[model samples]
Target: MTSSSTQHRPPIGIITTLRSSLPFLFFLLLLLYLISTSKLLIYPPHITTKITCQDSNLTTTNNHPKTGYDTELKHIAFCIAASSKLWKSRKEYIKLWWRPGETRGAVWLDNQVKIKKNETLPDIHISQDTSRFPYTNRQGHRSAIRISRIVSEALRLESDDVRWFVMGDDDTVFVVENVVRVLNKYNHNQFYYIGSSSESHFQNIFFSYSMAYGGGGFAISYPLVKELAKMQDRCIKRYPGLYGSDDRMQACMAELNVPLTKEPGFHQNDVYGNLLGLLSGHPVTPLVSLHHFDVIDPIFPGMKRVESIKHLLESTKYDSGSLIQQSICYDMKREWSVLVSWGFAIQIMRGILSPRELEIPSRTFINWYKVLDFTAYAFNTRPVTGHPCQKPFVFYINSTRYDELRGQIIGIYTVHRERHPRCRWKMESPEKIHTVVVLKQEDPDRWLRAPRKDCCRVLPSRKEGIMYLWVGHCGENEVIEV
Candidate 1:
């Protein structure tokens, strides 16, 4: 009976079998649809489907370092304010510092400049549009009135991809790398009014402390630029009394409720003196911009302005932080006190320690910089004693120009000290050291060394730390601190 029932069971309807299996077949088709639409099994998927942890396309205004933002992926636009009268004086500086595509914004002026083929003059000429804003007698006032229009035009002409819009004067020299670094430090998605004060406290007082010196240059984020473009004209109309472009900018920023994000690297250079005190004391930060070189002295004591700038570029290129770190000026105390200024150290006490008493040879003299003092009563670090009387005491001079030789000589006097075993420690007259300067021309990455000759002598290597013989033309000026 079981065999007969089994034989007859499946000879039953195909419709019945199909109906029973429909649910599983339907589930399989649904799974396939989901896989195709969701791209689950696809190899080499599109960007949205790929596992991406970072947005490599970062902008200056949208970057947040903690959020994996990179402004290097973006570009910056520069808006420069210049008068037709001062074009001659400022053209060289523009050529020296400004890059074509980076500084692509217009240079607001009354006339057109004769630009050479490779030379990058301002991208646009902002001639006096008397219809927009009438020309005025006060040049400063005129520039103040023109700023809003200039900024508006720059915002319009620059590619939407531009992340930061910087406003500067004809004299402003931008260290674009440092500027980018500073800008990258903050989340540019938020409004940023970044700049530094003038060198003179009085200048800052005359203007508002909140104001960004036009010469030093200031940066505005793309979002801020859009906001500024909207209100800039109205803001300028409100500040009719403001004479300087910087003051007007400050007034507008205040109206916008955007405070100055003071960046010390943006030097206005309104005051004249050696910058050694400031640069040496603070070496960690980058120097983004420097302005008013015509009024201020060349960075180094004797360097010409152009030479000083070239040296600064070369020094920074060679070692970005070393220029500031190595341009040290400090005083160390011992029985023989030493004053070190701008890489130079001088022994202040004549008879502090007798080399003969210490049993060192007289003819084999030592420069005091070679010595280190670790006695309970003495400062831990000082220059080691080294022979200074040797012929052709070779120094590798990395100067941009010839005028720097005098400064280097003066710098030598500031830190020069000698010790001799045969001599009594007397204040009378230290032995004369004949020094020769050798210019550095080889690769900056390599160690600087003078060609050896029987007539040429070099300082002995110190056990503590060897003093670097190569000095760049742009080294900080001598700053003697007690």
Candidate 2:
């Protein structure tokens, strides 16, 4: 009976049977392909690769060994990018901040750098070859590819107990204590990119508004760098035409979907000429890293670039938290607007000015683009004008010391050059005042709380041709009024 039925059914046609099973076959093949592809792609540094579960014991900001403690010198690993040819001159800048054995990080050079005798610089390490990474930027050097890899390369070294990895150029002078203070705000256990953009408006427009200028330096949290190291090369390859390591690093950050957590304290200093205006009116934040020391004029008017930075560092030593911090007070009797940039300069505006006007930086320096127009600046700038009401007589810091017995920092700023300013108002000229003295108490944890400008009180001058001010937190009822 089965033979007869089979004969009547006329042996199922092979073509018809194949059609019914094609859908299942296609589904099976697609699933297999995806599994194989994922297996191969998982090991390579893809932008989206998640390595969290791969290393369960990996330390995070919250789980870091010293998580509860504030960030310190040892917790940060700095990767300084330098060319072997330029290392000789740049080492001086490094020597300014790199505390041997205490500061963690390395100076990455292109070739073997001959360490000078008694050179107390960070350990010099040659960068891994980056010729394999393609770069077609007409205006930028190919070495940017190598420099961009510094963060990943640094991570590969597996520095111990590192909560964050900080990157900077060899010429970048870091206010390390201040940097630690600023970084202490964010959680290093999470993916955080801490830095600021360039001072040049054109520069930001040309590269990115969010890209952290590598010269000024940027900090990457341990968790982010661990992830970044996994896929940075491939991420770099995806953008060969990018200008510098900064934009390349930024490109990777873009893929990670982590936006720049801008800390204004990280100054790119993308300007040339006198840094007086810039430093004197620095945003009411801690001064972190100062970049482009090689390009701009010496920070201190009369000193060499190195000497100027060291000079500024002198004030940093006494009260790093208050270094270049703008504290405004009025010389009511003299009818003068006083701006005390503690440890930097004390600008005595000839006429009483609103604190708002003092807050805007003087455009004493030129933009990086060399554009003469005011629009080139990333920030608002008050022209260094002849108007007595707006003109500032900046007295650069001549000497600063910690008065241990007084529990305060005594800073004396002397006129670099006495100026004869025009003011028909018959107001007593600040030019008559030869020196400005500021006493700032050491507030070791000033940055731990929300950042706000410190208040300054104009105390009576003990001697003629002198002015004294006590700089500290604003009183509940106190206000900087003209």
Model 1, span 317-387: residue lDDT tens: 43332233222111132122211222211222333343212211111211122221222111111223453
10 residues in a row with least lDDT, candidate 2? 44-53
> How do the residues 1-482 of candidate 2 rate in per-residue lDDT, one tens digit apiece?
46676467544587688889999999999999888665331121121221111224333334444323477878999999999998778888999998987888888888997776787988778889988888898988999998999888888775699999999998888999887888887888889998998898998988889888898899999999989988898999999899899999999999999999999999888899888888888887888999888888887776898998888889777788888888888877877788778888888776667888888888899988787899998889988876655567778888887755546667778887845556677777776777776766677656654577888877654466777667776656666655
Question: TM-score winner among the candidates?
Answer: 2
Query: How much lDDT does each candidate structure score?
Result: 0.52, 0.81
Off by over 4 Å in 2: 1-69, 388-390, 421-423
Show model 1 residue runs off by greater than 4 Å.
1-68, 100-104, 127-140, 273-284, 321-466, 469-482
Q: For residue 281, what is the lDDT in candidate 2?
A: 81
Give me candidate 2's TM-score against the actual structure: 0.83
Native-structure RMSD, model 2: 30.0
lDDT score, candidate 1, position 311: 56
| TM-score of each prediction | 0.57, 0.83
